[model samples]
Target: MTNNDPKTQYNGIILLTSYLQRVFVAETIYQRVKKGHLGIRYSEAKALLDETYTILPVVEKTKQLSVAQKAQLQLITEKTLALMKGYFKQMPLSFNDKLALVGSSLYGEQMMNNGVIRLGKLFNVEVNKDFHMRTQFYEDRTKMVDFLVNSIHHNEQPDVNLVKPIETWVVDILRQKDYVLADMNKISEMIGF
Candidate 1:
């Protein structure tokens, strides 16, 4: 009855899936799967991957996957994490991108149907995926943090105004957390993928 781990794991899995979708986005699921080395879950690795799943937080806990599907997804997650580790090993996430992801996750977790990030989009600057592939920087934080904010006095395009604040917010949250960056593998495993 006190099954809280699923919700936590589910959130982490959704984050990973969202990140993978960005990395492996292509014209078709087949192409995406190939690009990611079949690392992403087959069902979710579509060209039109759901961005909301990544940005939002947990409300209701996830229903259990069918036994067969669970096994398949576990293998997929292993592959996916392997690929992710390789990229992360090249150059760790920029502080800004980490903020975006944390903000997005916070926004999603509060609502049964959250859309804070959508509002943030009105003021966001795009993260350059092309630059990521070229430099292997894997720049993806701005793409995630459409979620939440405290106040927005201006009503114009923000360029990079909100960028630094987001990073600050994330650190504020992390300071309150029990874990740090070294616990990343635990976060991934908590997904139970």
Candidate 2:
């Protein structure tokens, strides 16, 4: 589908969210290992994080995107990259510390589910269904776009202060999953395409 198509745009938003979720999870794993939380050796953790870093560009490049793809996607690519960089810069002492500040932010249910599945495949760790359920919920794309726009415009280093609003937005969206789903269903019915 063309970039201008609404369905295509919507799907792009979904994909962007998925990408961000993966980035967050990767960073968290890296920090966890570095902090001696995971059982893996330091070398192994570093190797895994390095591999993950390399794989990310491949994931971005795998899709043959148009020049207007980022623009059409509401600058999500730039914003997400900036967010990741900011998080890495901040580098909280622990994942729980970050979670406490952000409150299960950065991904919805599907994104978390997909991330868990990916992590399980890559690390051979059992999926934590409870953790997945606790974090899973739908996010509103409009708010996401707004958060990106606001966050990217800042000149300072990315930190909990800068990202907290994003987490709050995510939490709020997750809380209204039922209403959002109902609205989506109504819109689909009305479009009837």
Q: What lDDT would each prediction earn against the true structure?
A: 0.38, 0.42
Model 2, position 168, has a per-residue lDDT of 59
Candidate 1, run of 10 with poorest lDDT: 111-120
Point to the candidate with the largest lDDT: 2
What is the overall TM-score of model 2 with all chains considered together? 0.26
Poorly placed runs, candidate 2 (over 4 Å): 36-74, 79-193
lDDT of model 1 at residue 38? 48
* Candidate 1 residue-wise lDDT, 1-193, digit = tens: 1223544444444544544443343212222212233434333443223433422332222244334544544555555555444332122544434543454334323321112232123225343444234322222332334321212112333346556666676666546433323443553455554
lDDT of 2: 0.42
Model 1 — TM-score against the truth?
0.33
